[model samples]
Target: MSEKNREGKRTARERMAAEREKHKAAEKRRRALIVGASVVCVLALAAVIGVIAANAGKDDSSDSEGPAVAPSGAQGEDSLVIPVGKAGAASTLVVWEDFRCPACKSFEDTYRSTIHELTDAGRLRVEYRLATIIDGNLGGTGSRSAANAAACAQDAGKFVDYHDVLYQNQPAETDDAFSENAKLFELAAKVEGLDTPAFRSCVEDGTHNSWVAKSNDAFRSGGFTGTPTVLLDGKNIYQDQSMTPEKLKQQVQEAAKG
Candidate 1:
């Protein structure tokens, strides 16, 4: 064949291959769209079913006494209670946190810095409830253990500091995670003013077991359906994967201004 003709044929073959690739890509995208649509339809149907089930008056409340203290608007000086920012600060922010939740970890990393700044400036009071709802299901014993240790730290008057540390050093949601009991104790000791011996003993003996259970019970009662659920001034903050620090700051700002 003539060289020119050979080159033209080669180019035509390449174009055909490219066209085939494009066609395959389009088909793949169409299939993906179909799958995504089906998923959305299934989720919507499930949601409706869930609403019916929830309204069916099913008692999912765990058998335990309620939270140690109800979330009242009461304020106290020197009470270990979570502070409500400044006087007349629009809202009380309460976070129901599960240590083993990766999303909670992200929320902590995102909000900790800003919240600290606000707290330092006397602009917001943030309260936390360390619940273990995802314990056995997600992190198993490790989750429960970390929560237990946190409760001990709280008793030692280092709840806020130790709580931050727990979230900071949280392990993955797996069996291997609980192996860090020593690390948890180590972190707890770093909280100044905490009685290390007492904290360690409490963790070892599971002294805060009942309290943790009670907190979990209260978490359910407060309408918390998921971990890292945030309550701003007693209103729920609906969160999604795209929730950002700037958005949270704006929420806080709006709440503070009100």
Candidate 2:
């Protein structure tokens, strides 16, 4: 009850109060840190999911069994090579292409007529192999869909006509236009006897989707890197840019002489 005793007790009480406030502030800071870290982790996980969703279509060609169907006269499991001429022609030309590829459009534009001329003369046989690498690299289903439709056209015995029309109306590589089945049917109307209900069903049903996959598998199996890959008798003519359209004709002619 003395004055000194009272003052000592009051000072002790003040010290304890100050210590409790410090502990409370430290707890609040720890809780805030934990909350902030949880928010960051949640945001990071959402970003990863978004990336995966964006790339889902890019892996469509990963099926190792190839497509559920293949075009007629498919060579092994790698391609359904639609032939353009007599089976026993003197020269065999194999061409690999992606329908959405600009380079392929250019190649076809330049040499399409010459190829037809030779094929008609029974001097050369050409085989077309489809590829969808553009779809994998560019993140869309246009290439695969277009190739499938092309194979479907083959089923109707109008592969040559439909193939020509596709390149003739090919959209820019970045447009991803061929993903639309309506567009394919619209283009099919340009080819004779190709716009029937059966053709519509085939294209819309994606009846040749498996064929597209098989063709893509064949493309990979061949170990080539890009589209418009032209080979004469299994020899890569464009390996070093040594072959132009004229050069291709000459090579085929020379091969015929022997």
Candidate 3:
């Protein structure tokens, strides 16, 4: 080959190598970003394989700041559940959820319509057992406080509305926006009569704070190692990769017919 051609080929190879190095650098940065984002919400759990989740319980205890005043109409053991849907519904969806959990919000966003439809049709009942794992793990009272606010809404016969509002306006995974009663009240205002004096008092007094703590304790002790642990008819359906909203609705309808 000509000397000029040889020189040009060598330059082209060097340029190609440099481009490859640049691509490798970009991929490294991308992977680092992904891993860092996951770390914000992942907690290692014993006895669970490949279970990525926010903390179910950290070393610190939940905020047990008051007496365990069960919200009016709450059911289940220790009055830990805020029940929604009809009393005679055939299937019960037991949800161990954290208000501060991003995953919980995602689940709600995905399945809220189907859940509401089933509940409205009286085909499904939901037992929402709130947990404060984020507070216990991430050093904030947002989880417990938000759950308390939702309980307070239950007193006004508007738990589902307020619950949806909170998740709809959920903050970033690490942002503890729900720690403030003012924020809770602000959101409650969007739920029509939910921002009433009684509701505010219930939230301010933390009437169900102890109940929420008890519920969180149950979650940690239940050997279920994640937030948003959704059980349909006593089966952990959230782990089912094929479980979609339509599938869930069909299952509930079938159960209702049985």
Best of the candidates, lDDT: 3
**Of candidates 3 and 1, the better by lDDT:** 3
Error of 1 at 216 (Å): 0.7
Best model per TM-score = 2
Lowest lDDT block of 10, candidate 3: 45-54
Q: Which regions of candidate 3 deviate over 4 angstroms?
A: 1-61
Error of model 2, residue 75, in angstroms: 3.8
For 65-106, candidate 1 gives per-residue lDDT tens digits of 333332223233222234435665655677777788888998
Ranking by lDDT: 3, 2, 1
- lDDT scores for all predictions? 0.67, 0.83, 0.88
Using TM-score as the measure, name the better of candidate 1 and candidate 3. 3
Clashing pairs in 1: 85-124, 85-125, 92-233
TM-score, every prediction: 0.61, 0.81, 0.76
- Measured by TM-score, how close is model 2 to the native structure? 0.81
Report per-prediction Cα RMSD to one decimal: 17.7, 3.7, 16.5
Evaluate model 1: give its lDDT.
Answer: 0.67
Report residue 217 deviation for candidate 2 (angstroms): 3.5
| Model 2: CA > 4 A from native | 1-18, 21-67, 239-242
Show where candidate 1 strays beyond 4 Å. Answer: 1-88, 193-195, 238-243, 254-258
TM-score of candidate 3 relative to the true fold:
0.76
Can you write out model 2's per-residue Cα lDDT over 1-258, one digit (the tens) per residue?
Answer: 999999999999999999999999999999999999999999999999999997664465443344477665555434477777888999988899999999999989988998998899888998888889888778688888888888888888898999999999999888889999989989999998989998888878777787677678677777797998988898877574766777777877888899
